[model samples]
Target: MNVYSPNLELARMVLDSQPFSMYLGARLTAFGDGGATLELDIRDELRQQNGFVHGGVLSYAADNALTFAAGTVVGPAVLTAGYSIDYLRPARGEVLRAHAQVVRPGRTRVVCRCDLFTVDSEGNQTLCAVAQGTIAVAETALPEPVE
Candidate 1:
């Protein structure tokens, strides 16, 4: 199955603009047609005390994936209004992946759902969490990028 979006380059640029996303090494691997996928390699720093991937990391992926999915339909100037995530399992793998799609698209707001997964070395993916979010069109433009 083809997962890449035609707008991958533009979406990746937007993802790279976020300091936190860059810090986590997250990549916008796919985006467009009201869907998006974010991926991050698992690292020692992203683990919890028990050795599983941190919940916050998963939440971050979900939130960003949801917003990106919304962006495919609502355009670039958008913000995540709010979101809720349910952790389904402990994530222990080589990489973390979040796939999201717009549940509903609107002029002023968009609803999205995301599924978080952990991919093992052998390419097995385990569902770790699920999320739903509401994205709103930004009333003001985003600030200029820092030089």
Candidate 2:
């Protein structure tokens, strides 16, 4: 089942190119043939009025993780076509981890699902959100935005 080999260094470099992800301190903790995990330390600035991790943050994690998972199977050039997420609980913890896996892999598109979890000081994880996304393969990397 391990048909694809993952390049952690390449993945890290790709993530580092993303300013938003770098600003959030999100790191690629794990990457494999058809799975990836992104994690970020929780900060007060990332919290909402309810003192829970903001939904936007969770969404970003899910989106990136899902796309990265698909990238494992479909190469590096890919974009998220669309995705849906469901919040299961308010997230409050020391770290947020998003784990994603490819459900189906094809030449042009890949389906991925992600589970967002909150990890407490004791290292217990609580699932707070779930997401599913479709990734579209690209022939080449997208052009950088004009500043």
lDDT of 2 by residue, 1-147 (tens): 425567888888888889899899999999887999999999999999999999999999999999999988867888999999999999999999999999999888999999999999999999999999999999787775443
Report model 1's TM-score to 2 decimal places: 0.93
* Per-candidate clash tally: 0, 0
Best by lDDT: 2
> CA lDDT of 36 in candidate 2?
97
lDDT of each structure? 0.91, 0.93
Q: Extract clashing residue pairs from model 1.
A: none
Evaluated at residue 124, the lDDT of candidate 1 is 98
